[model samples]
Target chain A: MTINFDNAATTFPKPVSVANAIFKAVKQYGGNAGRGGHKLTLLTSEKVFDTRQTAADFFGAQTENVIFTVNCTHALNFAIQGIMSNGGHIIISGIEHNSSARPVYALAKKKKCTFSIAEVSDDPDETVNNFRSLINHNTKAIVCTIAGNVTGQIMPYKEIGKLCQEKNICFIADGAQACGTLDIKMSDGINILCTAGHKGLYGPTGTGLLISDGKYHITPLIQGGTGSSSLNLEHPDILPDGMESGTLNVIGIIALKNGIEFVRDMGTAKIFKHEDKLCRQFINGLSDTRTIIYRSPGVEYVPIVSFNIPDMKPEDVAEKLDQQGFCLRAGLHCSPLAHYSMGTTDGTVRFAPSVFNNENQVESLVKTIKKIQKI
Target chain B: MNMTAVSMPSVTLAIKAKRMLNEQGFKCTVKRAANVSENGCTHMIVVNGAPEIVIAFLDKYNIAYGKLLGDAMPQ
Candidate 1:
């Protein structure tokens, strides 16, 4: 059996309950949710709302504020573009996934707005100051990642959130990597939080969430039949219905409900500990090898660990590992900005563990890495 | 029983209102409101209780709603 360590991209081997929920939802929920009030539609609608409530309660948000999307990219697009639609300056961290980077870049490219990049520093305080120094009169919002995807570097988002609050700037956080591992909430001074249900939450790939604290008015990215305000040409000015314009992925959403329940039952702390233990084990086992680990002593990170083998390409290394029955992601990991910031033009292999991984598997991977270094 | 239909902007809001009202021992059912042509499409919470009490509960929870469609409304 292949041991999967590429959980950062999309968790593999989802909980059995999540799979069961998918099977059940496919058979039972066959109606368009929120389209009507028939028994079939209502049943689907109730299930959709139940998942929304679960997500809201998990994230410390009101039920109405949870807007579902296809993935983290879609959520970030909605939040970034929605807030910047009126045109203003925005700041994004230097190490950002393309999901956040590309949209902000598109806005700047279209001359709709201008943006600045805050260089993330080793010290959390200096990183916050880097963002603080970029603020100006036209700075309408600050888009940052809760934890970067490439190297799993945890940014001091709360400090930046406080900075946004003090400056009256809207703080939008990309929580794709941190959601299931960290206890995040709107109370962290974040105006908006976007994340993938598939990553840390162990949900299906097509589910994402955009949560708001009900403060800023984000223009809708897409508008269509929301089953409300249908007679009017204009989109309804509401929390979720305003943002969610198309029919939702009901099957994926119901499965996501079960996924979130699994997370809640296991507890974020316990899950983090399990994954982190695997990371530590991997790091320790690779200590005697020639592999270069990307972690810094003073920086905080999630369970992901990026490393490079001396004089070898990341993809080649990943290929070798794959032959040994291991799964690891290689390349820029869809975060070119992060690669540039780290000066890794070719990228590095990422080892991301899930709660299902254990020390024995990590040891085998570590031994494989050592064997690869000798090749 | 004095019944009223409370118009909510969306089915989510309507369902939310119904859940809140039902939990408090008030009878509620969600149904698509009769098309108010000029006002557009929306949903309503049919409550088998005082309309004033229903409105008060909605207001307390910050739930948004439109004008009441009136008493003895079609469910």
Candidate 2:
């Protein structure tokens, strides 16, 4: 049996309901969303709208605040670009994925905008303080990833959110790696949240979402036929219609709706407890000889781990595990800056478990890693 | 000779250069060096051709990077 451990990238083997929803969407209600007055199109639009409501409730956000996108990258781009014009300053964390890093860096270069990167710390309080130190009068926004994609570290969001609120700085969160996996309260002070429907939410690829309290508005990255405002050449200046241009990924949206419902049925508390137990069990089984690298303390972490065997390249270890029918992500995982910060320039193998993973699979993974370590 | 210039921020510029070289039927390899000015890592592409033609394509696509001169080209 194939032991998949790359749930952080995208969760695989989705629940039966997710698949059923996608199939039903494609077979029965395949139509452009919010485009035509036809019955089928309206039905598709309603299904998509229902999904938005589900996401809003799941994350403790307002219904109209949620906007669908192609993926987490698209959602992040809309939020970052929309909030700041040229020549503005923003704050970001050191442990950000390329999706966040690249866009911010590009904007910094093109617009000559200044950005400060806060350091990552083991203590949650220190982490919050690091962010506070970086803030200044020119700092227009603060962007953070709820969980580090590289180390599975959870940041001090509650404190940071309150700080942003007190200072009136925009707080944007990249929730791609930590949506359904972690419980996020909207009242906690986060202004904008960008997430992936495919990751912890257990939906297929090509689905993402962005949530805002409507305090900050951004121009759409791509403006074209949104199927509304057919008469005007200019883009519609409204909530989702402004940002959501072109044909919607209808099938993916329907599947994501069902996926969110599945999470609701399971309950976020129960899901977190199950994943935490599994992760702690896996960490306990590792011997002292294994170097477990992570940041952030006390707060719960996503079910992910990055480690390296002494005197061996991470790629070689990953290849050996692949030969044994175990799937894992090797190398920097598209975040070289993160690797540089962790001092793992050679990169580390990342193993991320999910709700679909069983304890037996964890035991087998441990045994496989041990056998490979001997070699 | 039409001279076009493209300025890539980092990393992605290297990937774009390699891809463009391959598409135009040229062999290319990406090289890495520590950029002291940037205080971080920087990468450049070593391609076998006239620099002007490469620069034009890169400029059209708005790919950002710098030019290599003298011994900077990989042997």
lDDT of 2 by residue, B1-75 (tens): 222222223333454466667888866655444342132334456666667767766677655565544445443
**Candidate 2 off by > 4 Å:** A295-300, B1-75
Residue A80, model 1: lDDT of 96
Q: Model 1: residues >4 Å from true position, as ranges?
A: none
Candidate 2 lDDT over residue span A1-375, tens digit each: 788888888888798999999889889887677654456765666677778778888988755567889899999888888887645889889888888888889998887578888887878888889999988888888999998888878888878889999999999998877788777767778899999999888888999999887787776778887654445677755656677878889899889988888878887677777776777766776754464555345655677888887888989888888999888888998777788888998989898887888888888888888787662
Candidate 2 at residue A148, lDDT?
A: 87
lDDT of 1 at A157: 92
Question: For candidate 1 chain A, which ten residues in a row score worst on lDDT?
Answer: A34-43
Per-candidate count of clashing residue pairs (backbone under 3 Å)? 0, 4
Model 2 Cα shift for residue A157 (angstroms): 0.8
| Candidate 1 residue-wise lDDT, A1-375, digit = tens | 799999999998999999999999999999898887688888898899999989999999988999999899999999999999999999999999999999999999999999999999889999999999999999999999999998899999999999999999999999999988988888999999999999999999999999999899999989898988787898888978999888999999999999999999999899989998899899999888888999999798989999999899999999999999999999999899888988997999999999999888998999889988873
After superposition on all CA atoms, how large is the RMSD of candidate 1? 1.2
What is the i-RMS of every prediction? 1.7, 21.5
Estimate the TM-score of every prediction. Answer: 0.98, 0.81
